[model samples]
Target: MTGTPRLDDPHAFIRAHTALMAPPMVPEVELHLAVETVAIWEQTEEALGEMGLPPPFWAFAWAGGQALARYCLDNPAIVSGLRVLDFAAGGAVSGIAAMKAGAATVEACELDAFAIAAIETNAQANGVALTTRLGDLVGTDDGWDVVLAGDVFYEAEPARLIGGWLETLNARGATVLIGDPGRSFLPQDRLERLAEYTVPVTRDLEDREVRQAKVWKYR
Candidate 1:
């Protein structure tokens, strides 16, 4: 299977914790991927263990992504029959959501091999077919009707880089939707609020903090 990556045990922590929802086993219209998350401003040394990375900690299923997932699941009208791209998609929740909502195709883009592997496993666990692409938004050109990003503006450098890429995409007339739960560097003025929601997490979830996340569009 050229597209199917190997699956592994990504739920050790979730299995230990009951609050977390197991990835649904049935193949259905909607799919959900268990993403990783770290608390806001936690030391990189402490946070990298879970994600297998260093400072500029890597977190997944952040509230912003959760909100977008919720919105996509609830609004099939928007995603149905469209080609969707989930940018820097750690868990691929938004991409899966779009697939569930009837998007013609869902692609998960991430630079980390581990994250890509995680998406591969979760997509199968949820019974939805997804495509994986190893891509970085900073200097990559991908054609997508809607470029979805979740909680990607937590740091200064990534924020600037992704922002610049988004600006270029916007200039070319692509719809860019960002989901951020008020992370320190979220560019608020540049987007229009689409929706908001509260997200839950496991005990190990660093931030362990649930916040209101919003979906904003720049089209």
Candidate 2:
């Protein structure tokens, strides 16, 4: 009787696996987050019946995402009445903040189906609406006025590709913003710092109780 849960019902999985809670840096918004990192990661792989699938990043509010969401909420003019894209939007924290800050529209894109489900459920939990796109939107541009990416510079190849794309977007008149907590792959030289925050995080995930995360604008 204990086989894998149906992968098609991601919303059910999300609801069953996570708790609806607010991130410490941005308490105005709530997300479905896993309490214990290892348990959720193991459960996700078990349920998917796959060994090499990506970790359940959607189940935690990383420091970078918390910092970015805090920035958006504190400075509403950055997203007010503009079209915003939350790229690699794990649980759509920044996107939800944009909507709360008066963005005209918010589109959250993620490569993981579970992330998409988490985003949708999180949006609903906060009483906001967000358009969800499930796919790899790395090289595409949909004419967003502002693009927000949080916690995306952890890997080398993706960081290289997305850094180039974000630069291109900035050159083409899009306001591109990035949030990161001093990750190894961040293109620091190409960005200008805007704001910083001390975000609380679980030690199991970040190895520290607090992280110094920053918001940067592509230059």
Model 2 is weakest, by summed lDDT over 10 consecutive residues, at 1-10
Worst 10 residues of 1 by lDDT: 12-21
Q: What are the clash counts of all predictions, listed in order?
A: 3, 0
Q: Which candidate has the top score in lDDT?
A: 2
Question: lDDT values of the candidates?
Answer: 0.65, 0.89
Tell me the tens digit of each residue's lDDT in model 1 across 63-151.
67767777787777777887788888876778887887888888888876556755676677567888898756576666777777888
Q: How many clashing residue pairs are found in candidate 2?
A: 0
